[model samples]
Target: MDALSKSDPMLVVYTKMDGRLEEIGRTEVILNSLEPLWITKAMINYQFEIVQPLVFRIYDVDTKYHNTPLKTLNLAQQDFLGEAFCNLSEIVTKFNHSLTLNLRNGSGHALQGTVTVHAEETASSRMAVDMQFHCLNLDNKDTFSKSDPFLRVSRLSESAVAIPICKTEVIKNNLNPVWRPITLTSQQYSSKDDPLLVECFDFDASGNHELIGSLQTTIAQLENLYNSKAGANFYSHKGQKKLKGQLFLDKFQEKVQHTFLDYISSGFELNFMVAVDFTASNGDPRVPQSLHYIDPSGRPNSYQQAILGVSEVLQFYDNDRRFPAWGFGAKIPRGSVSHCFNLNASTNDCEVVGVEGIMSAYSSTLYSVSLAGPTLFGPVISKAAEIASHSVQYGNNKYFVLLIITVCNIYPHVTSVQKFYPSIVVCRMELSPTSKKQKILL
Candidate 1:
């Protein structure tokens, strides 16, 4: 039982009599001490001569206990974890309860404490010391109101504990190894110009650190998706394009939902995947009508525009800065004779690969390749479905998105089949940070 345990105090004393400290049963220990000295700032000091070690015939507990904490240290704790172990005094404090230590003159000497402790990992036993000596008796405790204590130590209240940061990565979107540093209005400690540390409790950098990495960017898409949908909805409510309270509410909800700051505090992983459509019936490659068109001015077609816009915002702002782009309704780039349907899914690739490659190829194809007819939405979509269905195999963090790009021509002569469409499965992708998959549309 550690100092934080709330075990039975009587059991602790009983163990002392049994001379079987090692046989101490697991339980919690609660420290209930507040010197009258604390009130007058009478400079109440304590000296720890020897805290009674766990003596046990059959050790039980001291008093009330709660569920063992899942984990006690946070990531930043890694910096000095070994150091903490090397100097037991660091974890030991003036107010400790793991052992029923005898007070040196009973809580009014130079602060010091002792309790036998066992290492969970090593099982190595040693006397753990919690000391706070050398503190001046601030007879000025009341007078010290204006002066800050060089060192003030106490167990934190429930509300004072820091929240932990968590992450979720999309299969295709999280493809970056590095994150850009964010500028802080007020950088503190040794963290100025430093890369953001993910789980540090300092309110300042905890937020900035998560947003710069690859995960925050993927979350941004989810934000934009929410916003765009809402913006569109609010526009519909007014029966015209205009801002309204509902739109403002949407923005408020979005800020709360996706900002990496709040998510980290609440322990959330925000990752998502995006898949695009590519197929024939988009239009003849030679014509200016294709959704993947490269206009004479070199501007990309609208399909590329919508997808790229979303991708740009996400990649820049999310924790994962990469996305996998894919194409269907066409053969693998090198396949001879436009092979109708050989699912061309590459492990994760950047959106730039598809954007630049597709534009370049679309231009070249316009000049050198012939546009043939055969619209196949099913095969392309099915490929996306195959990837989406793998959530079970890949585990929970993975998700796939199929964003089909098309415009229908409602001519009565057209067939009623869903497969027959101006629509195309323009792109396919995996949206997890762990997945090394991408589909190039060239």
Candidate 2:
């Protein structure tokens, strides 16, 4: 498209779904280069049972739209270069998990360029390491007083790019500073044998940081330094000059963190539980603005959507689909405000048959019960803990998951959750209609 300068190329990825193309992601436009290597990665969930067809299209973005955000940019305004098509399974089955395909035009004629696709399985290990660092004798870079020191740890990629993993807080006016312990996960470092770049910088107020010293080492080497009670000497950016500053490891501990998949693969069952908020803050059930309002056109409300989204994925992992459902901040028949009550309106049994049974019970409770006072999470969490504790006592390998759906503020009862169940992993998801973003807290 460019006569004087090279073509500014960008790549768009799509997946064929039900006879239509759905865009998965797009790469950033590379300016003035015929061969462009993009750093942006498009993540896709690969299913082993089905064949997923992927399409890759290249475009030359105009110079006027170079400053536009990739998400908002219109692909119809750009010039089409070529495209390639392949199945996702083909790339994964390769020896090195990489495949190269020749590009073709709209008429299926061969083009000049070829695109290479590489598949890398994401690391599922949740293992992490914690270590505290301190400097012995550091080089001073400040003119008025001692230099404010901080440390930045980065992992070297296969292309030798330094990707920063974590950094320590800057201690003002200190030459030898002891930093607090920092944790590094296996996903960040990839492996203990992988090399890491540790750089000590003198923090400047004007944003121009001066590097005092740096060193290249691995996690295994740092562990050895902690065991031997030794310190490693720092050197300049180039290896020719060795500085007087020394880096010492104050503490090092490696934790074996197991992932969700690890537990499931080891014959552990996941027990699903749900709690819905029935407070007056949700507005009336008959109004369209209410979050708990059911539509006559069969459209689901926000609460129903949350239940379906989580239960559908987790139901396959559970051996029995019986889920314990409850409601909070509501008043039962001839009773005061109850923090927790069975969703099915059964006095003795709280467990529902399946996802359909849970949905039916929830709908029934909305009409039978009345919305009441302030929402409390302590009771629901305590009840879930009691079930989990009973299963553990009987030597049943089961993990309990409690999903709480509420629109009201939970700050009052958030602290008491740990007191009730310390070992339970709580994941809070906030979904908003005005905003397209979703926040997940783990």
Best by lDDT: 2
lDDT of each: 0.29, 0.84
Candidate 2 structure quality by residue, lDDT tens digits, 256-306: 776544555567677888888888877777888777788999998888887
Q: Which ten residues in a row have the lowest lDDT in candidate 1?
A: 36-45
TM-score, cand. 1 = 0.28
- In model 2, the runs with Cα more than 4 Å from the true position are 1-137, 142-148, 157-161, 168-186, 191-195, 203-209, 216-233, 237-242, 246-257, 266-269, 329-339, 370-382, 392-399, 424-442
> Top TM-score: which candidate number?
2
lDDT of 1 by residue, 192-280 (tens): 22222221110122233111111111223323544455321112211344322121112212111122222322322222234333445
Q: How many pairs collide in each candidate, listed in order?
A: 59, 0
Error of 2 at 124 (Å): 9.2
